[model samples]
Target: MSLAPRTCPPVYTGSHLDTVPQGGKYDGALGITVPLAIANYWHQLGYRPVRPLCIIAFAEEEGTRFGKVCFGSQALTGKLKGLDPTALMTREGQNLPELLQASGLTGNPFTPHFPPGKCFLELHIEQGNALETAGFPLGIVSAIVGIRHFTLTFTGKANHAGTTSMDLRHDALAAASSFITHVYNSALASQRQYVATVGHIKVEPDANNVVPGKAEISLEIRSETDTLMDSVLAGFQEFLDHTAQKYGVAYEIAKLDQIPPLPMDASLKDLIAEEAQAQNIPYQVQPSWAGHDAMILGHELPTAMFFVPSKGGISHSPEEFTPSHDIGQAAQVLEKVLRRVSAE
Candidate 1:
């Protein structure tokens, strides 16, 4: 019912976690605590459910240490195929196979197998401004957005800034800048659910007196529908090719990771909505822009997710917060839904 609990949970700090060095109070912790609270309430009331309930606190959803997100869920579902235990090194100079053996798990860590489930549900905080913007306290997730990470490199001649003629020079940084602009305009002009971000960029050369020779860009694109994602990516590819040719530079794009959009079960969504209505809670049906373990489980079993409002739509930081009343409301709604489902 509960996993590891923090000692001094993260609170409102003016600075980011990197500067302040604090943990978030609700990023991934709330999903576990809220369910435990619900179970405690039923125990206090001496009420027994018609069906059994199991709560799991997945080991590593954030991958903050290993640089591999969804480690627990991926291990459970056998998605860790081809993962070499010897190749994965930790901060403590530990490898995965050694770590597993130390913990008494004898087989390869990548070979873990989990049983099929009847139903799965995850309660989480809305990591975006959707619920707050919509003026709702709760939301039932309709789908989890598909994700794609792109690594792009633009190569051009590195020359002296003072001596190189503007007309004759091929500037890789300028070409990259053009593509960044296109990524913004195109995604903004597309469907409301489509989003694209150029998160990281690097320019080569000692820059004060040199024309940039190479540029590296890390681009991430997400969409609620796969078709829309494909369309936007195609547009981006065309623009990249055109920009490279026009600027007299060469470019390469490599897809680092791609996870397709996953839809929540229709029946489970309806059930949550009904429970929210019955409890007189304000709710909306929306899609999750961020990833979660529910997306991994939904691949095979019936899974549902309900979300509570996040303050200022901020998360993954020290400032992330959810009001106490909002948290209680979400938990009550969750309990109502689980009780209803147990009866069925």
Candidate 2:
């Protein structure tokens, strides 16, 4: 999908219009623009193959409207649960099914087909400091990390800030703050490549004069291994149980979503690496911290991902960019992979 704003809440609000250029010929529109160009190029070259080639513009990959990542991809992959139109809510309180219907998307995104394929490849900008740090123009991803998102709520008694003595007050936010710090330290203690983020937090009666009775926070943990992720989560759960017992508060840990980590097809990855070497493109095999559609698609198909360097490793913003030459190189790599797949 285009990098447009989604119709969800503050977190999900993403619009393609944000990336439109003043002159209307901007460079950073590679996600959609380049694929379109490649399809046109293949057509112009009269490259008719044994299998059908489809250039799709998937909707809501950014999860900007639903606070859920990989919505479109999940729907296609038969991973989405429940279809109640009224139950879905966006940031602005708009129903997701309504939005889909209004947008003329057939109102049933789950009906799409994702049959087995020879391979699936996605070309995206490497939204990190890796390529530039390694002085490479391209990267062949080895795996995409699995992500687990959670919504944590800590509940306690709300009391008058001035009337309650510091020693007697049951402050949920205070306990939550400590728990957040503990999470940080636990992840750091592992000394491995893992990320834990508490990106959103909301407290009831958020007033200066009142002790918070309830607080809800969003937490995300990503790691290359399910074992490490489970270990980190176990640490968090242990901390929560201990903190609640120590502080006389109640806590709830609700899993919002969990996606398994996906290692790209080793043979296909090696094939791409070989091709990159043949083309003399500076490339490296790296694991992706950020999740991508390729991770899910890779489960059923021989999938590989090609990454072009992002300028300063920025993405998901108007300034998110990679050079046009890098884009062209990635397309060339993708074309080569497609040709190889077609041959098989």
Q: Report clash pairs, candidate 2.
A: 4-14, 4-15, 4-16, 5-14, 5-15, 5-16, 6-14, 8-65, 9-91, 12-64
Query: Once model 1 is optimally superposed onto the true structure by TM-score, how far is the C-alpha of residue 21 displaced, in angstroms?
Result: 6.3
Query: How do the residues 56-97 of candidate 1 rate in per-residue lDDT, one tens digit apiece?
Result: 667667776566777777777798877876887777888878
Worst 10 residues of 2 by lDDT: 8-17
**Model 2 TM-score on a 0 to 1 scale:** 0.78
Using all chains and alpha carbons, the TM-scores for the candidates as numbered come to 0.87, 0.78
- In TM-score terms, candidate 1 sits at 0.87
